[model samples]
Target chain A: MSLKKTRFKYLGESLIEGNIKITAILAIIAVFLIFFFILRESLPIFFNGEVQQEITFGKFFQGIQWQPVSDHPRFSLWPIIMGSLKVTMIALVFAVPVAIGAALYSSEFAGRRLKEFIKPVVELLAGIPSVVLGFFALIIMASFLKNIFGWTYRLNAVNAGIALGFAIIPAIYSLAEDALNAVPKSFREAALGLGATPWQTAVKVVLPAALPGVSAAVLFGMGRAVGETMVVLMAAGNAPLFSLNPLESTRTMTATIAAELGEVVFGSGHYHALFFIGLTLFTVTFVINLISWALFDGLMSKLYGAKK
Target chain B: MNSKGHLRKIKDRIKIGLTGSAVLLILAILAVILGTVIIGGYKSISWEFLTQPPKEGMTKGGIFPAIFGMVFSLLMMLIAVVPVGVATAVYLHEYARPDFILTKLIRGAVNNLAGVPSIVFGLFGLGFFIQFIGGSLDRSLGQSGLFGQPCILWASLTLALMNLPMIIVATEEALRAVPQAERAGALALGATKWQTIQNVVLPQAIPGILTGVVLVVSRGAGEVAPIMFTGAAYYLPYLPKLPTDQFMTLGYHIFVMTTQSPDIDATMPIAMGATLVLLALTFSLNIIAIIIRSRTRSQLRKGR
Candidate 1:
């Protein structure tokens, strides 16, 4: 009787364990499904003869227009790609210096109480919704920025990029702070003991040591800025113009997808074109994530000396 | 040597000044964003605006339907996501071997899922959920379009998927905080592993799990892109009574008012009102989660 009961108990345990394992595996399956379905929908454009004729590689890459809904559709992605790059560049220029500065201060200089206060205030910025930020940009910041810079367009890449910079600062600040904090305390002491002043030690000793993780943080922020949708959709004047000027109106890949996806007919060239943009976005972000992950792991091992 | 020391002091003062300004700039930005919303929207908000549906093409009316829809969608998302996320976290922390291939793959998936853009989730929801699953359901049930269209169910599920990594990461931290000695004690008393986990581990982990749920709720409530194509409507006369129904949401409502409203000047106030509410909801939820998380950390330290 005892042996039979023990067998039953063991079976129940294994059953429960198996169930948990399967549930965990579902996450992996979900990721695969997202990629698979996105790819499946996009594949039709390449394989279907009609879609291929309409949205050929030359038209998509070389043509200088994106008038997809017109009588004669041109699906060149050059303008949209330029728009995205311009906004991302502006956002990085605005965000990286301030974020790194704040991170350095919080990690290296702030008093205990001040650090505690600054940390949550910075995090609070992250909790604000992108839509809310977009609304602010649309109604207020665009006008505010236009007045300051005397821009021709109210909603241009600069306005959108500044808002995007606000959205991105928290991610960069938090990660960069973590990287700064992860440097061994002994390193700071060594620099100070060698007659280096606080600023000299921070810039010459600590910054170099933390550069890997900080770079990773910047890469993650770049990925975030590239993928953000609502802010650009609402703030960037959704004009698919091929321009490098930050003050000019332009559209991003995310904004284009958000604005057009709602109206496009399924299985149309426009639909496939949007998916193609998504695929490109997914690939870019995936590469960024992969590189950041490698750098992060290297930094961790460097700091913690490898985990068992 | 004295002159060099004086130069170092000047450099330190300049660096300090710069970093201080950086901190001040962030604080000022936060203040301006919040202040602008509050100053612009506070007057438009009234009890009537909170309770009544929009009238006059969203120019003059309350966003009751939007608020109701957002809450309902959050409830639906909470129901769908919490169980799956906790189970994943439990398996990772408690059941699976640390170095197993499966474990690493799941971890990678979770990390990658978090990196996917919110709009991509919107596309996946449209393709997979509304078109694929819902369409299949409609056909199998012999119903024409009951589930094949964008609705609250698909939107919530999509949001839940977007938030799953966050929940899993948070819950895993919580689960790892549980001491192994307690688990061993429960098992040494002849309790089965599952039983020990159920009775002893879960109780301790509930606060931490709640924190994760709160964070997910905060995130889901604020996200607009994933729902824009999935279920959120520009205008809905009535609140969503069924999962299959389309609904207006605060974030989407704000988006519509700012972008698509006919009377831009008239709609600005209402949009600001809605923005204020959405900000309040997300910020309060985030604060509650942060407080709970800090408390949990303190308790863990005390236990140690």
Candidate 2:
């Protein structure tokens, strides 16, 4: 009887373990599946004759037009790519300095109680939905910005960029603060003991030590600005124009995909074109994340002396 | 030497002022955003508005269906995600060898998955979940368009997938907090490894698991892009009656109303109203999660 019970228990345990393993493997499969399905759907744009006839590589890269639903459709990616770049650049301009400054203040200046209060409040900003931020930008910030700057376009790249900056700030601040805090206390003590002021120690010693992590934070922020959909979709005015003016309306790859994918017929060239846009976004963000990870690993080793 | 020292002191003061202002500016921005949403939306909320479906081209009436749909889909998402996430966490924390290549691969995948744009997740859901899996199911079952289109099930699954990383990370943190002595004691009592986890570790990790659930709920409630292509409808008169039926959600409702409404001026109030509800829901969930997490941390510190 004891032997039979023990055998049953072993069988049950093994079954449970197997089930858990399979469930865990699902996460890995999910990542592979996202890449696979996106790549598979986007392949027709490159190889399929009908899709290629509609949107060739030369026209896609060289053509200035982006009217994918026009009578003679043109699937140029330049204007859209430029638009994404413009907004992302503007977002970085607004977010990075502010984020780094706030992070430095919180880590090197604020008291313990103040740090606790400020960190959560800043994190609360992150919890706000992108759509909500987009709405605020559309209705409030656009007009407010127009009144302040007297820009030609009400809903322009600057409006979307500033709102997008709000979304990116928390990410950069949290990561940069973590990196700053991770610098050993001994380093700070040594700098101060060697007759450096608090400010000097922070800038000359700790900041340099945390440079890789801070740069990684900025890159992560850039990745977010590039991929953000609703803010640009609502506030960037959805104009696929190739202009460097921050006050002019523009479109992003993410905005283009969100706006066009809902209406495009399945299996059409236009559909494939949107998927192609998704693939571009996927690739860009993937590369950004990879670089950020490399920087993060470097920072880890610097702080810990070396890794295992 | 005195003049040089004075100049350095002045520059240091200026630097401190700049950084302090930056922190204040961020806080002020958060306050302004929340204030505008509240002031514009508070007057629009009514008993009838909360209980009825949208009317007259979505410019009038309540968001009951949207709220109902949001709740239903989130519940379904919780059911699907919690188990898979906890299992993955358990496998990583307790079962997998620390130096195993597969473990590292899985960790890398999870980190990358977190970075994928939410809109890309929408595309993945539309292509893989709705078209591929749902279409295959319909074909195999001899059903016409039964599961091959956007619906609650597909949306829930897509959200669960998008939220898997957050859940896995949170659960793993919680699992790591379980003391090694407890596991050892369970093992010494003739418990198998799986038994030790099930009876000894998980019981202590329940609060942590709840924290993960709360975080996922907060995030899932606010995400609009992932569901936009999967199952969210512009207007659904009746609540979803089946898993396959399209549903209205608060986040998507705000998106459509703000972007697609025929009368933009008329729809503003309704949009603000929806935004207010979404903000309240998400904020409450975050607060609850924060409280639970802090409590867990305090308990762990006490135990230590």
Clashing pairs in 2: none
**Interface C-alpha root-mean-square deviation, candidates in order:** 1.0, 1.1
Candidate 2 lDDT tens digits, A90-137: 899999999999999999988988998788788688889899999999
Residue-level lDDT of model 2, residues B88-132, one tens digit each, is 999999999978998888888888888999999999999999999
> Which of the CAPRI classes, incorrect, acceptable, medium or high, describes model 1?
high
Q: State residue A173's C-alpha deviation in candidate 1, in Å.
A: 1.3
Off by over 4 Å in 1: A306-308
List the global CA lDDT of all models. Answer: 0.91, 0.90
After best superposition, candidate 1 residue A88: deviation in angstroms?
0.9
